[model samples]
Target: MAAKRILIVDDDADIREATQICLEITGEWEVLMAEDGVEGLAIAQLEKPDAILLDMMLPGMDGLTILKKLREQVETQTIPIVILTATAQPNERKNFDQLKVAAVITKPYDPMTISDQIMSVLLTSR
Candidate 1:
């Protein structure tokens, strides 16, 4: 199988870099990073990565907004989306669940296990 491609949309530089490195080392997946929702939306349509790791909060558009936009578009409608968030409060997780997101991964995640966590989501989704 081809190496899986992962698009990460987050405003935090450190988080992006750390996640990128972790995914590369563990899964050897091709990874792309976007600073905000606009760039993320464009990249998601253009690159059509195997999966998306989207941050919950962004400058112009939030993750839920981006998710709605992507789900509205035919090109991105079926791609699996895993929300990366700092806080997974009960109500917020419930809200994201209603959005039909794959999962809401809280921040300060274990880098070593990040790929497995995401891959599990994808594999089970299939």
Candidate 2:
């Protein structure tokens, strides 16, 4: 099978690098990193990665807004988007449920398991 391609959109540099290293090294996957939503959108449109791991809180366009924009576009609408949130608060949970995301990955996730977590959701959604 071809190596999976994943795009990660998070503003935090440390988190982005760590996730990239973890996913690339452990999962043997191709990883793309974007620091904000705009760059993320651009990459998503151009690359059409297999999956997107989106951070809930970003500097400019937060996850929800990015998700909406992605959903609106024909090129990116079908790509599985797994949200990463610090907490699954009741209200936020409701919003995510309504958004119908592929999955919600809680923040502070284990680097070792992040790839597996993302894979599980995307596989099931397929």
Candidate 3:
């Protein structure tokens, strides 16, 4: 079976690198990254990755806007989206739930367990 491909969209280079390293090493998944929302959205459309790990706060577009745009397009509508947030506020969580996001992973996450969390969320979402 082919390994799962995941796209991570975040402005923080450190977050993107750490996530890429962890997912690649621990989950054995292909990791694609984008530093800003515009690039992230473009990559999502072009790559069609199996899942998306999107940062809630971003430059140029923000996560909610990107999520809405992804949902509006047929090519990306069905892709599972896991939100990476520093603060999962009640209202934001509600919005994410309404948008049918896969999960909301709070930031400052444990690198050792991040892959497991992502994998588990994807499985349960399916």
Candidate 4:
């Protein structure tokens, strides 16, 4: 089978690298990355990745806005998005839930377990 392709959008270079390495090693997945929301959106539309790991607190376009935009377009609407954020408070979580995100993963996550968490969420979302 072909490897799953994942797109990770985060402004933090360290976080992006760690996640890319972790997912690539653990999941044997093909990982694509973007520094910010605009690039992320462009990649998502062009690549049509299997899933997106999006950071909630982006500099320009926030994760929620990106999510809304993705949902608005037919080409990328069905792609699952897993939010990576430091703020997963109840109210924030509720918002994510209402937006129909595949999952919300809190920041400072375990690198070793992140791939599993992402996979688990993707599976359950199906």
Candidate 5:
């Protein structure tokens, strides 16, 4: 099978680079990245990646807005989205759950297990 493609949308260059390095080292998937929501949305539409890892807080547009827009479009509606956020409040979690996001990953994530965690979500989703 072809390696799964993941589009990672984050405003932080360091986070993006770290995620890319971690995911690539596993050799199980291909990674694409965008610095902001606008670019992220464009890449998503053009690439149609298998999954999206979107940062909840962004400069151009916030993650919730991006999620809403993606859900509205037919091409992107079915793609799984994992929200990456630094906020881990219960209310935020509840809201994200209501939005039907695939998962919420807190920032300062475990580099060693991030790929495995994502893969687990994908497998179970199937």
Candidate 6:
């Protein structure tokens, strides 16, 4: 089987690069990255990745808005989305759940375990 494709959308370059490296090293995953929601959406449409790791806070557009737009589009609606955010409050989790996000990962994450965590969610989601 071929490697899974993952799209990483974040405003922070460090976070995007670190997460990409972790995923690439941990699994047979092809990682694609975008700096902001606008770029992320464009790449998502073009690349049609299997899954997405999106930051809650972004410059051009927020993750929530991006998620909404993604859900609205037929081509991307069923794709798994994991929200990676620094904000892990109760209400934040509730909102993410309300939006039907596949998973929510808090910031200051363990780089070594991030890939495994993502895989776990993807496996269970199916």
Q: Name the top TM-score candidate.
A: 3
Model 6 lDDT tens row, 1-126? 789999999999999888888889887789999999999988898899989999989986888899988888888888899999888788878877877899988898998898888889999999
Give one digit per residue, the lDDT tens place, for model 2 in 1-102: 788999999999999999999999888889999999999999999999999999989997989999989998999999999999898788877877777689
Which wins on lDDT, candidate 1 or candidate 6?
1
Candidate 4 weakest lDDT stretch, 10 residues: 90-99
- The CA lDDT at 105 in model 2 is 84
Error of 5 at 71 (Å): 0.7
Report lDDT per candidate: 0.90, 0.91, 0.91, 0.91, 0.88, 0.89
Pairs of residues clashing in candidate 2: none
lDDT of 6: 0.89
In model 2, which runs have C-alpha deviations exceeding 4 angstroms?
A: none
Q: What TM-score would every model get versus the actual structure? A: 0.93, 0.95, 0.96, 0.95, 0.93, 0.94
* Alpha-carbon shift of residue 87 in model 1 (angstroms): 1.5
Q: For residue 36, what is the lDDT in candidate 2?
A: 97
Q: What lDDT tens digits, residue by residue, belong to model 3 across residues 1-126?
A: 678999999999998999899898889999999998889889999999999999989988999999999999999999999999889889998899899999888988887788888889888988
Candidate 4: tens digits of C-alpha lDDT, residues 33-60: 9999899999999999999999999999
In model 5, the runs with Cα more than 4 Å from the true position are: none
Q: Cα-based RMSD of the predictions, in order?
A: 1.2, 1.0, 0.9, 1.0, 1.2, 1.1
When summed lDDT is taken over every stretch of 10 residues in candidate 6, the lowest stretch is 91-100
10: Cα error in model 1, Å: 0.3
